[model samples]
Target: MTKDLLGRHRAVLPDWLALYYDEPLEITHGEGRHVWDADGNRYLDFFGGILTTMTAHALPEVTKAVSEQAGRIIHSSTLYLNRPMVELAERIAQLSGIPDARVFFTTSGTEANDTALLLATTYRRSNTILAMRNSYHGRSFSAVGITGNRGWSPTSLSPLQTLYVHGGVRTRGPYASLSDDEFIAACVEDLTDLLGHTRPPAALIAEPVQGVGGFTAPPDGLYAAFREVLHERGILWIADEVQTGWGRTGDHFWGWQAHGRSGPPDLLTFAKGIGNGMSIGGVVARAEIMNCLDANSISTFGGTQITMAAGLANLTYLLEHDLQGNARRVGGLLIERLRAVAAQVPAVREVRGRGLMIGIEVVRPGTDEADPQAASAVLEAAREGGLLIGKGGGHNTSALRIAPPLSLTVAEAEEGAAILERALRSIS
Candidate 1:
């Protein structure tokens, strides 16, 4: 059955739309943190569909909300007054921490970020953008233009002249050996020098944690230091929180809070988890910037009634249950467990991430060379052992991405870790 589906998928889908495993499993149903494939093989879902399932699989609250909203109305374009949209927007704005914030919804992170780019470019009247190296924002033209990861970025043509910035990955770079403070200074100096050679950029956009680049991140205060430089030059700061938002990072509600010395970003974009499997994405900014567009604009499907209801329910559940705190506690233990497992495996290079968004970089034993084969081997092995994880990185896709739902429990974490440990040992 799985083979038949794979054959049909290859026949119909774009080759670039990648699927996992030697034989990709069609996930038929899920409950809590576990999912069953069409063959009825139950696997612990650690990736949570790239971390979209923020709470739990088949969560009752989300299901109820979606069902009730569908019964009422599924969609009413931005043309109509959406009560759920407004409610979700109000909640998000308050949680966003932006002063005098305004919210605009989109169906995906790409659109949210595209909207952000539009706002920044129009407000600053600049076509230039600054993005972190090894970053993946979205697949849209404008989003891809600012993406610095060559593996993910398909084209060089862009409406915005994007300048790649340093300091997104602290472990590898010209300043990799520097102390945290020194690294921040070096990156700031590099940015300053880059600015000297180019026109004033509209905004410096970056992911607090590079998701597709293998959960890489800079030193904690690096962005805050850069914020000082950008602020002096009137350049906006846009935090791409698609993977790092809504308390996935443990200590911070938003990943930018890791660099909260400078307060909130001028613009913040988020998606993935807030809807708990529903498509919900948006940008939050001060009214001045969000209101910068002179002409009219509305997303045909953005903030549709169904998605908004889901967002409202999911956000409410996340906050009410303090899933952020759960992420902190459980994720901390999970990382520690994985680190121990990695220590015993020669091919495991490094385990890094905050809260639930962790990455284990695979490398050749006793060498810094990326080991993508080892990553693939481990991924396949884990699946055989009833665990579902993900792999990605800028360096030949050699890192295992382990972003589980924020509501992960301690016992489930241990179960998943044990399976992963066995998988790593099998590959090693």
Candidate 2:
């Protein structure tokens, strides 16, 4: 049955839509932190479907809200006043920290980011954008244009004149050897030099933690320093929080808070975890920027009744249960455990990230060269050992990404870490 489904998927799906594992397993059902494949094999789900499932699988609150909303109405276009959408927007706007904020919903992170690009360009009257090196925003043409990861970006053609900036990846870069203060200074100086050479950009869009770029991040306050420069030039700072939002990073509610000294970003884009499993994406900005467009526009399916219900319920559950606190505690322990394991595996290059968004970079035993083969082997081994994880990096996809539901428990974290330890050993 799995083979037949795989055959059909390959026939119909785009080749670029990659799947994990050499022999891909079909996820049949899930509960809490575990999911079962079609063959009745249960695995601890650490990736949480690329961190889209912020809460546990089949979370009752989200499930009940989705069911109830579906019974009444599944979708109503943006033409009407949507109560759920309005309520969710109200909650998000209050939490967003932007003064006089306005929210615009979309169906995916790509759309949210594209909307952000549109707003920034229109408001500033500039087509130039500054994007961080090794960042991945989304897959749309507009989002792709700003993406700096060569592995994920397939085209050079772009509607925006994007200038790639320094300092997104701290471990592997020209300034990697510098002290934290020096690194920040160097990156800011580089940004200043880059700006001197080019026209003033509409905005500088960055991921607080570069997600597809292997969960890499600069030292805290790097953005705050850059914000000082961008602010002087009246350039907007747009935080792409698609993967790093909703307390996944543990310490902060929004990833941008890591650079809180600079105050809130001019614009922020978020998706993935906000709706648990439902599609909910949006941009939050000061009213002036969000209202820049003069013409009418609306997403056909954005903020549909069903998705808004899910977002409201999921956000409520996340806050009520303090999942962010849980992520901090459990994820801290999990990282320590993995760091211990990684210490014994020479192929493990680095263990980095905050909270649940941890990454284990794989490299040749004694060299800095990326070891994608070892990463793939470890992934296959982990699957065999009843654990499911993800792999990603800008350097040929050699980093093991471990972002579980924010509600992950200590026991489950320990179990997954043990399985991952054995998998890393197998690869070594």
Candidate 3:
């Protein structure tokens, strides 16, 4: 029977397609913060579908909206406007405070980033761009061009533009010695140097808080300084809120606001939390830059009626229930617990992040090098202990990332922390 199902599924998929996941666990269903695999084993989900499922799996309102939209009309080509699309854009703008900000919808976080980069490149009419070291943008030519990781390079290189690398902020260890002010100053200086070195560049793009880069938040004053420097150089600043946006961070509806900066970027990209999993991303731009476009950029699948409904409902649920507040309360508990765990365990290096976007760096005992194996052991042990977690950069496999659903409770967070503690102790 399993073989029959496999054969049937195989018929629907392309032979050239690849499976990118590891240690595959077949999932059945999820409710709130708990997911059960095919074997009926429940796992506490600390990894919220790569930080996309903000309100939790199969949220009532979000699913209901999607269902209603699907029953009505799932798609209306860009030649026409749909109500859900209109309402979603309006609500998002209202929440984001980007007055009259026009939106261009896409299919994924990477696609939104790619679109933002395109807009900046066209607006600035420049060939060079700057990105933070160790940042993960997207795999497209332009995105890969600006992404700072050399590991992304392969047989094919991007033809769109040249990339200039800048220093990402560091707040701990060798980077710890520098005060927040010092670190921000260094980033500003490095960006300024890069701007001069690559003059007339199109834009400087970065995550408000480095997401896959170990949930690292940039130093204070960094975004303001970048905006000032980039604007002075006639360059646009693009905020990639792929992982950090949509209330994953507490207090602010968008991660960009969590930076506590005043100036807004030329363009902003969001995807993960927007659709609640229905494949939607919104690109909101400063009105001036938005009006600069000559024609509408439409997609075959972007912002379909169903997608808009799901996203609008997801954002609504996040607001009505004040999930951001929950992210604050619950994420605070998780961070504090991890800090306590780190203090107790020698292998645990640091716990960093705000709200639900948390990372715990597990250090090797001998060389002080990042111990990815130890991190893997911890993740596996957490699974055995009935919790699910993810990892991030700092040594691809070394940094343990814990960004659970914003709806996760304080008690659940405590359980996750306890599981992490047990896992770390066993490894040590």
For 1-428, candidate 1 gives per-residue lDDT tens digits of: 88988999999999999889878889999999999999889999999999899999999999999999999999879998989999999999999999999999999999999999999999999999999999999999999988888888999999999999999988887898999999999999999999999989999999999999999999999999999999999999999999999999999999999998999999999999998999999999999999999998888999999999999999999999999999999999999999999999998889999899999999999987898888999999999999999988993447999999998999999999999999999887
- Highest lDDT scorer: 2
Clashing pairs in model 3, backbone N/Cα/C closer than 3 A: none
Across 1-428, the per-residue lDDT of candidate 3 in tens digits comes to 43454566569987644331334566679988889977788989988788877789989998899888888898986769777878888877666656568888888888888888778877887767777777777766777777765555432366455554444536443344777787777667766776665558888788877777777766656787778877776888788988888778886767767554655667888888777778988688877776676876668888788898888888878888888899888888889889988887888777888889998887877545778778888888888899988887642436889988888888888888889889989998
lDDT agreement with native, every candidate: 0.93, 0.94, 0.77
What's the CA error at residue 269 for candidate 2, in Å? 0.4
Among all windows of 10 consecutive residues in model 2, the one with the lowest summed lDDT is 389-398
CA RMSD, predictions in order: 0.9, 0.8, 2.8
TM-score of 3: 0.92
Regarding lDDT, does 2 or 3 come out ahead? 2
Residue 166, model 1: Cα distance from true site in angstroms:
0.7
Model 2: lDDT of residue 255? 96
Instruction: Point out where model 1 deviates above 4 Å.
Output: 395-397
